[model samples]
Target: MSKDSIINNLFRVASNMFTQFNTEEPLISEKTKVILKTTEGRKELYKKIISNPIPF
Candidate 1:
């Protein structure tokens, strides 16, 4: 999948999780960090993947 798609999916998943939890402290502390880290990781991965182009 493309970098944009992966980032979009990450946001979707985070939103769904937050909706399900509906808590305050957990949302601010734990879940937020998790989502942020996941996004950052995806970005790094996307950069690496894109930098090294594959032949079809």
Candidate 2:
């Protein structure tokens, strides 16, 4: 392959790697972080759900 084609391929690979890295990150909100941080928060969330809940 030509030098120009090799450079273009490298740029393409770099762009794909960046996109994958960006999307792999979890998007957590502040409220979600709080809920996951303590047992009380988790219990409060658990209380809101019914044991025999039907699927929507």
Candidate 3:
């Protein structure tokens, strides 16, 4: 409720969010990107995807 506590809470929340954001890996992994660049990679990726596809 004090001004100092409020500011500290805000800082703590912001830092935690930023730290989590920075630590996450990219959604499209490096190998996936590399595979997507070439036809062979595309075929491989497609096959893998179809092998265990979403039920829907």
Which of the numbered candidates is closest to the native, going by highest TM-score? 3
| Model 1 TM-score relative to the real fold | 0.41
* RMSD of candidates 1 onward, in order: 7.8, 18.7, 17.2
Cα lDDT tens digits, model 2, 1-56, are 65444444644575566656555554545676566456666555445543555698
lDDT of 3 at 5: 48
Alpha-carbon lDDT of model 2: 0.55
Model 3 residue 34 CA deviation in Å? 0.7
- Cα lDDT for residue 13, model 3? 77
For candidate 1, give the lDDT.
0.67
Candidate 3 per-residue C-alpha lDDT over 1-56 given as tens digits, one digit per residue, 9 for 90 to 100: 65444444644575567666654666446675576667666566556655886885
Runs off by more than 4 Å, candidate 1: 25-56
TM-score of each: 0.41, 0.38, 0.45
In model 2, where do residues sit more than 4 Å from their true spots? 1-26, 51-56
Q: What are the per-residue Cα lDDT tens digits for candidate 1 across 1-56?
A: 77769766866786687778756556545654564468576676568767997999
**Candidate 3: lDDT over CA atoms?**
0.58
> What does the lDDT read for residue 46 in candidate 2?
49
Quote the positional error of residue 13 for candidate 1 in Å: 1.0
Q: lDDT at 25 for candidate 2? A: 54
> Lowest-scoring 10 consecutive residues by lDDT in candidate 2?
2-11
* Candidate order (lDDT): 1, 3, 2
